[model samples]
Target chain A: MHELAPPLTLEQGLRWLDLIGILAFAMSGALLGVRKRFDLFGVVVLGCVTAVGGGAIRDTLTGQTPPLFLRDETYLWMALLGAGLGFALGEGLARFERTLSVFDTVGLALFAASGAVGAINFGLGPLGVVFAGMLSGVGGGIVRDLIANEVPEVMYRRDQLYATAAAAGALVVVLLHPHVTSFQAQLGGALTIVALRWLSRRGWVSLPVRRVPGARD
Target chain B: MHELAPPLTLEQGLRWLDLIGILAFAMSGALLGVRKRFDLFGVVVLGCVTAVGGGAIRDTLTGQTPPLFLRDETYLWMALLGAGLGFALGEGLARFERTLSVFDTVGLALFAASGAVGAINFGLGPLGVVFAGMLSGVGGGIVRDLIANEVPEVMYRRDQLYATAAAAGALVVVLLHPHVTSFQAQLGGALTIVALRWLSRRGWVSLPVRRVPGARD
Candidate 1:
């Protein structure tokens, strides 16, 4: 726990990862919009929203007003670029859900770590931290799906762990925060979520759903 | 603008209206949850979320963090009570969509007025104020529908003017703020929205939708 010293290298690495995650998220959103046959304006809007939605929700929950993306336009630009790329690549990108999944997982992991850290700094309890982290990881996707008029995959898709993985990652960060540097804890948390996502994708892990009698399909 | 004097009577009236709106919104959410056949816990959660979601989002956007409901649990209690009432009259209430619509309209109108006032106080420009107001009015319903796995009625249903009415109401508040008292402006705004809703519901007003070929319905 290096309280006085800053971990410059890890911090830089995390920043790069965060940017990549944002780009991936924005592109995924744009791709979905294109597939849905939304107009050009709608596609761009969806991309930007997906890229920054989770972080905005997290900031709002933690009492951080104005949101980071609004203050710093660089993130918005990155999201726009991702959206442009997605719109240009449109159908080609749609064919590779695996690639999209990888990027989405990256975004989810980093957001979970960052969201948890923000909540912790805001003096939130463990439950609040976990909830914030999970929301930050999945909020964008939920909004995207909602706009697209589909069930949010995170809520219904039991084939792979999404929110659960995020909660676990956030929990790890909270547990390890006192014993390690901030960068270390965040990195560890992100990796843990990534591992869980990968395992779930490979069918090695999944959450169970109980059958409800006479439920609508 | 009556900056130096407070309109105590109008303020009290607005507070009561806000409470009614919250209760109506919560019950609407609970009714939907019941119709969806969600568990009792899910019904309660939906109700609470629907009641508070709009206000929370508006507060966050306006830089008023921690949200009003979190700081004041009275709103949450109202939401819970609304949910209880909705659950107790589940199937019977489900048969009366018209009754629900009237309450929803009241909620929407009041929320629009308050949200616009909040944005104006926060020093947002006209566009931001209108957006915040519209979101505050329609945001809760959108979340409720999303959780229930349906397209937000505000987005798709053209039978009545919902978002447009809220936006128009917000615009009225923004326009009237400079010349009128706060209470007067808000009241004017709310009345404008309610009027629009009523007119639209009677099929006297509706927005036009252009059809796109090769688009999924």
Candidate 2:
């Protein structure tokens, strides 16, 4: 049971968190464009599109038209800002894994949570919600990999803890939706996901799916 | 505007042209995926997906559920064979700019015609049909560009006579739908489009849009 009560106020903190996460993701997108040696407009387009492309796609797929990109356009602005920001601060960001990790964690949590929320709102049950969450969290990565002409990290290296983290987080969200505060539930889920990924990277944990009867090595 | 009569046989031929074009486009997509060095499964996904992606997107935006990808997996197989064929002969293809250009012209004609057909069926007027035609033809390229981390070639460089060919072909498709033999209409439209592109490239002809009104060198 969370200490925070229902009617969770959207008074500013949560809003800002989502915004900052968008900003970070936009920067990441812009940085990619920069690495590809595109012009400024091209860089901005990549950043903005990569940042909101997943959400826009999910929305369109679910029949939510006009898309968030058309609605706020702030996401676009954020992406533009992100391009300039990335150009200026890319090296500093690369040097600090801790800070970058924090942004990545927040972005992952919001996207996954929102994806599940969106699914549940659309009258889908747990399984559908899980699928949506996974899409939301890692859809951009797939797009990113596709642009870079590489196999999607999540699709190939099955042992990688990226989309798996989001899937686990989404499942937890459904379980906790009725019992606790959305904030705590979200934070807890996000932490769990990030922790799992970090641990996996260090070989501190693994899945039980490896146990196959009569399986060839 | 004053040529032939409407006939069932013509309509049948038009459909064949459209489907053949779809298969051709699918093949091109698969070829691109293979060139990008995707694994077998990844290649198949790219091949089938790039072929169907734009139309699927147009369908979804227009409220066609499950999109075209779920309609028939035949498109998927089409892409796989296309990719395999390209993989087997890609080295030989690299030196043939003339053949590539011809194929590109045919693809533009087919895609533009089909896209117009879709939009008209959706009950849009001429302008909407025009937009639909361009989107259908260029949307796949846009997606490919984004994934390949290239500023969409459609936007940055207009030297290839890309969107214009699609729009002109679409005009012919819509204008001739009820008139001349459907086969004649479609094929004529396709031929006209190819001629326009080739003429523009060879004669240094282009639309009037330019970077700036007056800029000193």
Candidate 3:
């Protein structure tokens, strides 16, 4: 087994970034619930699930039980708050799609970085670290989609670089960890992911889709 | 934290039951993959995911890392074999719906019982034990339905007492653990689940669905 680095506390800047990411993700989930016309309970459930689902999955897969939210109810409260905000805002929030996307990107980057670091701390190999990071970034959205009875947008949507951005961020953290402080590596990785995702969205850059010959209707 | 019981090895009879359950669940998943017209890889992935997804989720939730399949390759091989069998059987398997249902019931019982036992061993409380057991029994099928882009049958299909059966089995184990040996508790629980499920199917006992008062077609 590989020796893992000790767990490190996040700096103040990273802490704020983490909180913003959680709130953004929660809002996104709540927004989806509203669009789906779910009830109040459903909206809150979606928000909490979206905000903490990724990290919970990662922690569980890495043998961290009860998850962070269960340990500290603050995460749950934040998700509920986001859900309430989304419900209150209703369709009005649709006008802020661009802004929400920015927050989502930041959240994804931070989650990817933290997931990678956490996996390494658990003595996971490179593949495990990358998988954990990507999961932490995208798992919440996937769960939200699943609850909505739809295919995960990340898996089928060729227009989005969601998983790709997360992978890149995680890879950066893993590659830099050997030569840099955890904080430095996380910072670099998060920045890279945010920039890449933002650029991709702005340029409408999409991954290639495979088409079957003569299948077009 | 409660003190967990020591891990117990499966007796010969239980081992056979376990194997049959795995095979049955695997075939069910493979059959679904065939119905969906998925590629070979997709079929296999679906099969394996269905066979192990629930236990994997439960274990992860309870802080068991690298899961049972990761530690033992037999489960993977078995799932692959199931996928191949499913591919070969094709639509022919659908003709044997009744038989398959029987197998599925057996699988559900065994999984529920074992899941409850494992949760108790992991020092879970009564509610946690019940939840873990039910999840282990039904989670895989839920995941399979999600991958196929459909609502989980257990959640929406009131006609089938799928989740109810699993929950009953789990509850039995949790309630009987204090009064009975682990082996006895598991055996009794599994039998109860199978009997309850079979009788429900035979009697056409469906859970009541609360329809919206103002709903119109």
List per-candidate RMSD values in Å.
8.3, 10.2, 9.3
Q: What is the Cα-based lDDT of residue A1 in candidate 1?
A: 55
Question: Can you write out model 2's per-residue Cα lDDT over B53-96, one digit (the tens) per residue?
Answer: 67776676556666665786665566566656655665455665
In candidate 3, which residue pairs get closer than 3 Å at backbone N, Cα or C atoms, i.e. clash? Answer: none
Residue runs of model 3 more than 4 Å from their true location after superposition: A1-10, A202-205, A208-217, B1-52, B61-63, B66-141, B151-217
TM-score of chain B of each: 0.92, 0.76, 0.91
What is candidate 1's lDDT per residue for B1-217, written digit by digit as tens? 5477755786787777788889989989888776766555456657877998898888876767777775555677788799888877776666677877788888999999889998998899999999999999989988888788887888978888999999999999999999998888998999999999999978999999888998876
Worst 10 residues of 2 chain A by lDDT: A36-45
Residue A31 in model 1: lDDT: 93
The models' CA-based lDDT, in order, is 0.84, 0.66, 0.81
> Which pairs clash (backbone N, Cα, C closer than 3 Å) in model 1?
none
Q: What are the per-model DockQ values?
A: 0.15, 0.09, 0.15
Report the CAPRI category for model 1: incorrect
What is the RMSD of candidate 1?
8.3
Which numbered prediction scores highest in lDDT against the true structure?
1
